[model samples]
Target: MKKTVLPTMLSFYAPDLREQIEALPEGTALIGISASGQAIAVDLDAEAPHVLVCTSSGGGSTTVLRSLTAQFLHQGAHALVLDPKRISHLWAKGLPTATHRGNVAGIHDALVGLGEELARRLDLADSELDAAPRLIVSVDSALAALRQLTRYWETFRSKDDPHTSPAVAALEAALWTGRAARVHVILDGTPAPGVLGAAPHELFGTVILARVTASTWQRLAPFTGPAPKPSRHSSRGHVIQQGESHETQAIWMTDADVVTWLTDPDDPQS
Candidate 1:
């Protein structure tokens, strides 16, 4: 039997999701990966879904803070979310996707293979996999088994390059198609709406910051519109008026963010 990396479902909610999801083939279900207080959801099979990204602000309310449309992974659809907080709604909809490698020879092998696979896909260096495993299998009863198997991954290596770390390889694969796939990233905390950190530019583009304060929008004013013309605030001094009005100060993104989406990986404008 071929060794596979199965998706280990974590402590996810939504009884409806469970009902609709379980009916899906293991490869055709929505899987969630939660780490470092962050939750990211993906559609492993969403070749037809839009890549809608939702971000949240601290209101303790799981209502739609803001919504945006961007070019997504799948080729033919639009994505919209009522709220960034209610990400569980995606599951309830039975959105089919996951980062799972697939069924292995039972729990033990499944867990270990997944860790090794994750290390290979996330561009993690061999040294990084020492004691800390960034990727995890969220399935029940299998967590312990997976923990036991990942230990052996310390010895696993890619075929072409013996020294190529598992994480590094995984990162490379993740940049494109691979054993597992992610759909929409669920932002629980406030940060850049679509930031992938100091990661390669290929990692992310067209991030929509959900909400911004008037002052915050002002900071980006220079980038937002026409240049500030010389003003006679005082002699020998020039000032630029950013145009007044409470609503003008409000934050909003341009259609460019939507037009220049990541799906068009070939697009230079992206």
Candidate 2:
């Protein structure tokens, strides 16, 4: 079988590209360009509410999350980023619509807060009330954070507390219920054997592989058919959905670009 390849560069600053992205539907965000030069996008409100990005180190997983978060913010949504490394997506640090948590404690608190919000939304749903603005929780290095969270709980739990990590539990609940309430998670790394209940394919509606390999595909996404080989071009990836893979170039934007996009009120179209 023949394979598709992506362009060497897909500029986020191109005027036409920017226009197309802005013109996307309320809940849709442009992710990248397809192999045939079409604009590839995902609709969080209806399709693929949560996305999992599986990739090796330096394989552009962070780039995918950054692009999605920026688009979500631009669409008048709120973003919560749990980055234990404290280095991914630094552009979101001081943004008004974004909340960044780098430490294990902060990440735990944020997850708990989301759980509370989810409860409120569930209540509103029961009453048929309006939902809040869309919330995108992007977890950078999610596996590492999960491990650290487990250790943190072990060290800090009281005698009467439950054995499982509250943060993880909350996250699991969100995975099951948040789609209806417009709360979404964008996990930037692959899940471990026991993390997230080990059903990543069902939990994450969409999956993107930046650096594809046979073992990784079978482990993280067995139902997606044979894994597409890694693209020769760096930053290229595939978005697998419903047993089909769409070859695409990962969108790349500099930290300064993100800052300008957030702060420049005069250039709303920019």
> Cα deviation in Å at residue 191, candidate 1?
3.1
| Winner by TM-score | 2
Model 2 misplaced stretches (Cα beyond 4 Å): 1-5, 125-131, 268-270
- Residue-by-residue lDDT tens digits, candidate 1, 73-179: 12322232222122322321222222322222233343335445544644645465333322212221122223333443445535664443342233233334332
Worst 10 residues of 2 by lDDT: 123-132
In candidate 2 the C-alpha lDDT for residue 87 amounts to 85
Question: Each candidate's TM vs. the true structure?
Answer: 0.24, 0.92
Per-model C-alpha RMSD: 19.8, 2.3
Q: Show model 1 residue runs off by greater than 4 Å.
A: 1-87, 90-189, 192-203, 214-222, 225-270
- Specify the poorest-scoring 10-residue window by lDDT in model 1: 244-253
Q: Write the per-residue lDDT of candidate 2 for residues 1-270, one digit (tens) a residue.
A: 344566686778765777787788777888888877666777776555788898887778888888888988988899999989998778888999999999999999899898988887877753453436888999999989999889999998999999989898888788878886778999987776565665777777678887757888887677767877787666688887666678888777777777787789357544
